[model samples]
Target chain A: MERKNFLRTFALVAATGPMIIDGCKKDSATKSTTSTTGTTTSTTTSASSGCVVTPTETEGPYPYVGGEATNPLNRVDVTDGQTGVPLSITFLVVNTNDNCNVVSDARVDIWHCNKDGYYSGYANQPGLLGSKSYVGETWLRGYELSDSNGAAKFTTIYPGWYGGRATHIHIEVYVNSVMKKTSQVTFLETISDVVHVSTLYAAHGVNPVRNASDSVFGDSATDLANEIMTLVGSVSAGYAGTYTIGLAL
Target chain B: MYKAKIKLVYKQVIDASSETSFEKAIIHASYQEFLLKSQAYNAEGKFKTFSRMKANDGRANSLHYKLSFSVLHFIEQLDNKIPVIKDNLGNKLSFDTAAFELIESHIEDSSLHKVAINYQTETLTLIDFMGDYLLLTSADAKSNEPSETFVVKMQPGLSIMNYQEINQFAINNLQLETP
Candidate 1:
């Protein structure tokens, strides 16, 4: 398939938030805790070998482009399972480069599943009501432009999983008014287990498995698997994760 | 439209061979020719020009062009140049040295946005073209390295847009001569 077509298909899957959320919720429940710090050298067999730094040639300033302004796919009502207070996850976009040069005007598109293993905008799924599941609610998932040092912050609910993928959030980066790249960040399955412990397991008595058995969690080199930490029991309901990504322009 | 005054500086450094003198003379002559063309464009309502000047530094093997004008006018001039002088065609226009190094080609239309040419330690930098500025640094120097930082600060009247837009315009319109 052509690269553009491939991207279009992947984008469709990405826009379909409920399917992804369901996959994640199912996998997170049965997964075992894995190491968060070690590199995926053993698993990533097809990693790109050449590491030359080549400057990218500029294209047209592609203006007035339009797609879906926001996703209405999956909505997870976040509540502190223990205290019953609503939980809001604060996401901070951090630049991976050492310079910390904030990428101003860079757009960040983020989406994930809700707590009950249902997505917001999926139509075919009988589980989702199809009408307007959190469609107008921009609070859970939305887009934000990075500030001077390439930082963006959002308050959202902790995402849940569905069938066979780990608990992860998908992010798309647009630099200089063009969509440049996409990457998914995963919490350490152990950390995901902790989240499961706080919500599903703690409330309904369920335990999720490791990423190795998940259908979507394959040996793909492109997957940026890593561990991130949030305050377990803070005044802010302690549901948050920080993800750092480097964009090559 | 609000009137804005801005300055643009173009710089280039050449090699140090016996032919260097000949190269320098040709560069000076070409610089003059380029300036005359720019002035003609300005007169034709391509840009509103306050002044355009050139300077040469033999010690650095460098030549510089400084232009001051209104932002909107300069952009208008650039809009014309963008389609005419592509990278390939621009290369054919002739550099004094056959080995003339093109450090950077940042032209938007006929209005030269920023062009830097370097020969050895001698560096050429262009700044404050209409609303934006370009900076060139030695590849060897660290970010915190204590080197003479060439600074050309612009006045507050100019507006800065996204660099990507300018770069894109340059790439699409860039033409080089097919040898």
Candidate 2:
């Protein structure tokens, strides 16, 4: 009985040994081939190779400024070819972390319409009331750096109502010379009615009704109506308004 | 006495909007990734076995190294899918994309060892593994004859660069008129 039990144990051990050896052999064989063929390439540290190094230089045929360059409205006239009483717009630029103070070098470029309901530099069509200057022209639309407070201001005339859409202005912001965002500001229609009745729109011969129907104006308009505010009791002279924008860099 | 011929094929397209600098960076990155991932196997002194093992088995550290390199090559190729833009002056710019592909190894030898790899936007095909023509006896019988032949194919995807990034880079770097 002792000899029989010993033989049984020996047989079982032999069977398991071959199975384990075979498994190890199979693994080794695979490793051999892989090592032979795999000596082809590497992956780690590859991502860093994608980095690009750029040279620094300054080059420009920058736009010209007219009127009071100190005010945002005047700067818009120089850039967008708009004239008359300038619109005062202000905005804050922030970064990915929602930090409003992005940096001093952030550039802000703004452009919009004129009092007579037309862009200055654009050639006026025969039937159009005002000259064409802003159409396709980017001269007046240029960039300006932010102050230490991450604040930027632009001076431009209140855009006349056009194309049945509300009056508005377009703005683009750049951080450290990189374009980061684009937006627009709208004016209240109720304010337009007030301007028309007060002769502010008439002083510039800009019919708010006509501007409300402009095709481009209609499509490009944003909701700046609530933000529009006229300088109280200044009905005799050109209209004045200010807009403040808060940006997420 | 066994002899075999191996062929390597690669294919890729530069995004139409990609700047020359960005393309250069991507190519360099790909090469680095490939080198880091490929492995070298030494079979000079080891005992020969009947069945083959998977390349990634931990017990086969040498083989694992090779597999890792192949995977790295694939990752590098796929990395091209990330769009890059650069100013003409060589400043790096950021962009986004949808997909990419990479193929590291597609090798075929007369020893009946065939490997085909396909990943991302690339495909590799290899054929003709250990066969009678790869045997020492067969080579001895045909001492002066040509060795076995095999084929490999690779189809790399297009690398796309963002138009807006390029436009911005050019405008900022080249003094080009803003449109």
Q: lDDT of each model, Cα atoms only?
A: 0.37, 0.38
Maximum-lDDT candidate: 2
Give the TM-score of each candidate: 0.34, 0.33
TM for candidate 2 is 0.33
Give the per-residue lDDT of model 1 (tens digit) for A3-120: 4465468569668856644444432233223343545222111213322222223322211112222222112232212232134443344445535554666767565566544443
Model 1 agreement with the true structure over B47-95: per-residue lDDT tens digits: 3322221112122222122111101121221212221112222321111
Instruction: Summarize candidate 2's per-residue lDDT along B1-179 as a digit string, tens digits.
Output: 22222222222343223344434333343333222222122122122211222233334333322222222322332233333322233432221211223322222221222222221211111123343211111122122446443321211422212111123343344443323
- What shift in Å separates residue B66 of candidate 2 from its native position after superposition? 54
True contacts kept of 1: 0.00
How far off is residue A92 in model 1, in Å?
5.4
Docking quality category of candidate 1 according to DockQ thresholds: incorrect
